[model samples]
Target: MKKYCFGVDVGGTTVKVGLFTVEGQLLDKWEIITRTENNGENILFDICESLEAKLDEKSIDLDEVKGIGIGLPGPVLDDGTVLQCVNLGWGKFNVSEKMSEMFHGIEVKAGNDANVAALGEAWKGGGKNFDDIVMVTLGTGVGGGVILEGKILTGHNGAAGEIGHMHVEDGEELNCNCGGCGCLEQYASATGVVRLANRYIAKNSESTKMTEFGEDITAKDVFDLAKEGDKGAVAVVEQMSTYLGKAMASIATVVNPQAFIIGGGVSKAGQYLIDAIADVYVKYAFPACREAKIALAELGNDAGIYGAAALIV
Candidate 1:
């Protein structure tokens, strides 16, 4: 009987790999630099090589491994076909098919990185107590994933949780990376916080601590200043929280998840951030969904690997 499995989280700069027992206990983990040269053609081969090396080091036979699960930084169809991963310089292709071939028919599963992370959180992280949840990642961009009854809700064409692109503003002058204006990501992401802070600083004539950093301000700086009672910083946080809370309330009317799991870099602001969003969420949420709990993600960076492993577990 198979006793082990592997998980891989592919990113632009590196690949995170983990070895886990079939029961979902992680045994070891490591990382490898991502060589994106040649349109990332070597990426898969490199991951395979790393996996093989890991097996050898652990003295485990190929027959003892059940399968491998992978998470990629782009939309992935239910059938494991990656529509297109621009950051990886990859075009449409079957990730499961190619990896299975390389492993001589071993089972392989693939999913969008954000979705997989949500699955991981449901399985063992912040949302472990609930079977239904929405995970929002607030990093360079805002990403989201939904889980229902412990399974990922991969929508048609595998784009169910692109929450960042939800139109949140009426007249945004700047465009989001997705090419839309006034997206939730534009005001809720870490970069988005900086943008808001800058705009607030530009218009407010009041003295504040944010100006101490001048042009080198950051999301953390804004949150820190807010915690320290800086009016300008507090205003920026309030604006960001308003957009996020409103978007989440709209989502609740549709999915009505048991909980909303907040993750990614900006979430590091901790309970203050959660409280801010939760306060706004209740104002707009449907009466039936008003009790949905908002909580912080527990897995941190390791969430991706854990989620990938869950694909096969």
Candidate 2:
């Protein structure tokens, strides 16, 4: 009989699940809408239903499954408790325990989504060659995961890699959802990029091509405009890149990881964003830490799914 494991990545909009062989090949995959309206119970129900369907379709017996791993967008307690996912409307839920009960005798494991992404990158993406790496996801919000000596470092409170919450500017006063001000995430994420662009448009409307797109625009629009030599768009990209580089330099000074693996939607900006950030990172980074490499994520959207599978192995 063949052996397999189930890996699930839970996001606000969708839950992606994959079945993988022990050797890391993804045999099959599926996705379902993540319904957070029912306090996450609905999401769990959706996962169970989808997995059963996939098993039936593949003619796979439950007995051949080794275990189930999940990546959640919240801090998972040491004993598998999910503590308040702001995006999912779940708080203090025994995620692993509940899933184990739902799956009968199968083992269930869970971790923070960012940590899982890091593990995924280490297992199959850009950081595969390096045992020590920091994975940063640049999306609506900044998320991060740290790997040291081939192990995920969750710190004492399971917030070890919450580098996004680190303060970037003292007394500068940028509001953050975490109730803090001047967090790195506030200035280095896609949302941040949009905010900066909007501010630039408000102050210097004449310099932007964004005015042509009307009142509402996005970070991608800014990048597109910059590609067309829009002055305001170029300025926004430069500012965003500088802040991101400064944040990375701070991370390097402390963690000194072998590589900083950049992932998420914003990373799609590719070499343009990479080169811009690198210019500032090398300037501010400690001499020893400046040697660390900055690389684009290779796995794209499938990273979380593959990383969840890695946890079970």
Candidate 3:
């Protein structure tokens, strides 16, 4: 009987690898550098070497390993074909097939990083109790994943849960990294919060504490001030919550997830942020969807590995 499995989350700078029991308990975890040189040709080789070393160190035989699940920073089709991953210098290819070949016929599964993270949450994190959930990661940029009936929903092109690029405003001059204007990522992400704070400070000469941080102001600072009842900071936080909540409400109408799990660096704001966004979410959400729970992700950074393992475990 298979007793173990491996989870690999490939990011731009590093790859997080986790070894787990067939029963879902993590046995070991580590990280390896992601060599993006030569179009990331060495990425798989590096991961394979790392896993081999790990297995050898643990004295685990290949016969006892079940499978390997990998999450990539790009759109990944159901068959494990990655359309593109510019950050990793990767192009269209069957990642699962390649990795399986490198692993000498071991089973391998693949998925988009964000979606796999959501799957991890659904399987072992905040949304584990719920059958359907939408996970929003408010980091440098907004990332999202949808889990329906406990399955990752990777739309026709593997871009199903890209809630960050959902248009939230009109007539905006600035373009998001995705080449879109007024996207949710532009106003709801960590940088988006800073942008809102800066825009507010620039427009209204408010004698607020935010100015103390000056140009280095971050999303955490904004939230801290907002929690302290600073008017300008409150406005900025409210605006961001409004955009995020409204976008989630729109998503509710379509997927009607049972919950929205907020994760990432920004989620460190804690329950206060959840309450603030929940207030706006209720107002904008359909009456039937208003009951959806808004909670913080419990898995933190581990969600990616857990979700990746879920692909095959």
RMSD per prediction, one decimal? 0.9, 1.9, 0.8
Q: Is candidate 2 or candidate 3 better by TM-score?
A: 3
The best-first sequence of candidates by TM-score reads 3, 1, 2
- On lDDT, who's better, 1 or 3? 3
- Give per-model TM-scores: 0.98, 0.93, 0.99
Q: For residues 1-313, could you state the per-residue lDDT of candidate 1 as single tens digits?
A: 7999998999999999999998889899999998888889999999999999999999999999999999999999988999999889999999999999988789999999999999989888999999799999999999999999988888998999999999999889998888999999999999999999888878874667787888899999999999998989999999999999999999999999999999999999999999999999999999999999999999999889989989988
lDDT of 3: 0.94
lDDT of 2: 0.85
The lDDT-based order of candidates, best leading, equals: 3, 1, 2
Q: Which residue pairs does candidate 1 place in steric collision?
A: none
State the displacement of the C-alpha of residue 70, model 1, in Å, after optimal TM-score superposition. 0.5
Question: Which 10 successive residues of model 3 have the least lDDT summed?
Answer: 203-212
Query: Each prediction's Cα lDDT score?
Result: 0.94, 0.85, 0.94
Location of the lowest summed lDDT over 10 successive residues in candidate 1? 204-213
Better of 1 and 2 by lDDT: 1
1-313 in candidate 2: lDDT tens per residue?
A: 4399888999999999999986788998888999989676688878988888888889889988877889999888656788788778887888888988887657788889998888889888999988799998998889999988766787777898898888876755568988888887877788887888878888999877887776678778888888788999989898888878998999898889999899988898888888888999999999999989899888888888888888787
